[model samples]
Target chain A: MKLQAAIDRVSLDRANEIAKGLDGIVDIIELGTSLVKDYGFETLKREFVGLNESTLLFDGKTIDEGEYEFEKGFEANADILTVMAGSSIDTLSKTYEVTEKLNKQMFIDLLEVEDDKIKQIANFKNAIYGLHHSKDNKNAFDAVSSVAAFHKQFPDISNIAVAGGIDVDQAKKLSEQGIANIVIVGGKISGADDPVAAAKQFMEVIK
Target chain B: MKLQAAIDRVSLDRANEIAKGLDGIVDIIELGTSLVKDYGFETLKREFVGLNESTLLFDGKTIDEGEYEFEKGFEANADILTVMAGSSIDTLSKTYEVTEKLNKQMFIDLLEVEDDKIKQIANFKNAIYGLHHSKDNKNAFDAVSSVAAFHKQFPDISNIAVAGGIDVDQAKKLSEQGIANIVIVGGKISGADDPVAAAKQFMEVIK
Candidate 1:
């Protein structure tokens, strides 16, 4: 399982510094929605000039105007962009097509989506289906159990990513479970005193 | 009924120019989600100057991290900010609390959400429940009928706003129906050859 470090709610300069520090150390560096909504994509595209080795993912959380958001996100040099699973099927299909045509990736954020909705959108072969827990929920996230249940429900969706307050131990267990392709650690890794050291710890455990 | 002129898919300068143009004419001026994502709330707070009249609505389309997004959005001088109804109940409640505490309005974008979900979230009595059609969904929207049906379904929820390809005739009908509190028009008003003239025409019709 690959480790994806999410950098969120920070200044662009700080985010760039973190990305450069974590370059090639983690599989992916996610510019979380807060960054995108706080600083804007144009800044990310123009000013955020690091990540020589790590892939950059912009969590646009696009719920509508999928084509425009995807195109803009790709133009911002995002290797992957996220669209909400709660978005209309038309929006999902449009974003998937845009991602495929651009040869980039799309991460479908499965936040607050019903099973029926997930089943309908599970056909995007190249897209990574993210099993996300709401940040405001204040609930415990059992990543391993959530992933197992999601796998059982949508066996065809091979590319799975799980997020929501994930820690190093949970990352290790997820790696052992051998189901999720990417284990997204946000505050646990990025919010630590030494993000690089924390990322390294997570990488070691997952490895 | 009120007219909300939405400025979207344009440069920040253009958005400002349009917002300036539509000020005082329309009941509300929406800096659409594209602007919030493209330029950001910080930029909007700093650069988007000159809205001397008309309520400013930032279409944040906030799905999660509700309190943070809402606080930032309101601090950016937005009189109103939007949250996705499809968001977890926890997120919705948190955002509602933030809005209530801050004395700002929250517009719940009911895009692509099932009626059951609507029924659950309808109790946010102060929120303006928006019946929105996804721009990506290539489907026709009957504003008058949709508002009528939604009113019938959620009669207790007084505030209603409708969007998606609304025209002057439909605006007139919605005003006549006396259901929706706001009639949100996008390209029809903002994308017109003469935006002020177009807005005036709609205002005349609704009156």
Candidate 2:
């Protein structure tokens, strides 16, 4: 399994510093929705956010106006962009087509979506289906069991990612379970006192 | 009934110019989600986005991390901000509480959400439940009929708003319907040859 380090709820300069420090340490670096909404794509572009080794994913969480957001996100040099699975089918289809046409990547955030809805949107073969737990819900998320169930339910959809309060132990367990393609760790890595050391620890465990 | 002129898919300079021109012309001036994601809140703050008369609604479309987005949006001087009804009940609850505490307003965008979900989120009495049609769907929307049906279904929930390809005639009909508190017109008003004239026409008809 690959490791994705998500940096959120921080200043742009701090996020950039963290991203540089974690370059090549993690497979992907995610600039969460707070950064996008607080600072925006044009500013993100102006600030020079290219990584030397790892891919960059901007969590746009697009729900509508897919073409515009995807185009701007890609233009801003995002290797991967995210769209909400809860968006209309047309929106999802448009974003997926944009991602494919641009030869980039798209992550479908399956936060709060029912299985029936997932079944409808599961046909995007190249997209990564993300099993996300809401940040505000003070509930615990079992990454291993959720991945097991999701894989069993949607056997055809292969590229899977799981996030929400993920830690080193859960990352190790998910890696051992051999189901999820990517394990996304947010505050556990980005909020740590020493992000590089924390990322190394997660990388060691996942490997 | 109030008229909200939605400005979208335009440059920030053009948007600012249009907004300044439409200051007192419409009841609400919506800096659409495009503006928020394109230029960002920090840039908007630096530029100064206060209106002379109309309430400014930034379509932040807060899906998760509700409190943070709400706090930032309120600080950015938005008279009202939007949260998706498709969001988790927890997210909706947090955003609503923030809006109440700030004494601002929240508009719940009910795009692509089922009625069962609405039933769970409809208790925020102060929120304006907006019946929105997906822009990418290319489907015809009857704003008047949708409002009538929504009112009939969720009669206890007052303060309704409707948006989707609204024209001057439809605006007149919605005003006659007397169900929606706000009628949002996008390209019909902002994309017109003479936006102030278009806004005036809508205001006359709705009144």
Candidate 3:
């Protein structure tokens, strides 16, 4: 399993510093939606200028205008971009087409998508299916159990990722379960006092 | 019926000029999601410092982290912020609570939300329910018919807003239909050779 570190709700300068510190240490680096919305993609794109090692993912969470958002995301040098699973099938199909045409990747965020909706959108075989929990919800999420259930329900979804408040221990267990292609850790790693040390700990556990 | 002129996919300078020109002419001035993504909310917020007349509606299209996004959106002086109807009941409820506390407005974008989902989310009495057609979708949307069908299905939903490819004739017809409380026009009004004149024409028809 690979580790995806998400940097969120911080200034562009701080985000850049963190990304620089974490370069080559993590598998993928995510510029969270807050950064994209707070600083704008034009500025964020400039911040992402020279990362030699890790792939950059922009969590655009595009719910509509998939083509424009995808094209802009790619132009910003995003190796992967995200779209809401709750978006129209037409929107999902369009983003997937753009991703394929650009020879890049798309992560479909399953934040509030129902099974019926999921059934309709699961045909994007090459896209990474993200089982995500909303950060605003006060309810607790059992990441391991959620992943297991998701795998059981959609066995054909090969490239799967799980996000929302994933910690080092939970990530270790998820790695042992051998289900998700990538385990995304946000505050647990990025919000720590020493994010680099925290990231190292997570990397050790996931490996 | 109110006219909402959405400014999208343009440079910040152009958007600001357009907003300045259309300020009091339109009932609501939407800073489209593309602007928010391309320019960042901080910069966009700064640009919106001195608008005197129309309510500024930022198309945040927030899907997760409802409280944070809502707080940031409102802090930017937006009178109205949008949340995706496809978001979780928890997320939607959280955003509604924030909007209520702040005494601001919330617009729920029902781009691809299902009837079952709408049934669950329809109780936010103060929220303006938006019937939006995805821009990425190639299928044509009959705005008047869609609004009528939506009104028929959810009679309790009083404040309805319809968007997508609305022209002068369609806006006039929708006003004549007397179903929607607001009609949103994007390219037809904002993309016109003379946007201010186009906006005035829409306002005349609606009024």
Top lDDT: which candidate number?
2
Q: Candidate 2 residues B1-207, lDDT tens each?
A: 999999998988888888998999999999999999987788877774579899999999999999999999989999899999999999999999999999999999999899999999989989999999988989899988999999999999899999999999999999998989999999998899889999999999986
In candidate 2, list every pair of residues with a backbone clash: none
Per-residue CA lDDT of model 2 for A107-140, tens digit only, reads 9999989999999999999999999999989988
lDDT per residue, candidate 3, B96-206, as tens digits? 999999999999999887798899999999999999988887789999999989999999999999999999999999999999999999998778899999999999899
> Using Cα atoms with residue i matched to residue i, what is each candidate's TM-score against the true structure?
0.99, 0.99, 0.97
- Residues B12-128 of candidate 1: C-alpha lDDT, one tens digit per residue: 988888888899999999999999999988888999975787999999999999999999999999999999999999999999999999999999999988889888998988899
Scoring only chain A, what TM-score does candidate 2 earn? 0.99
Q: Which candidate comes out best when scored by DockQ? A: 2
Pairs with steric clashes in candidate 3? A40-B40
Tens-place lDDT per residue, model 3, A14-124, is 888888888899999999999888877887777655478998999999999899999998999899999999888878889999999999999999988788888888889
DockQ of 1: 0.89
Model 1 misplaced regions, further than 4 Å: none
RMSD of each: 0.9, 0.9, 1.3
| Predictions' DockQ, in order | 0.89, 0.90, 0.83
lDDT of each: 0.92, 0.94, 0.90
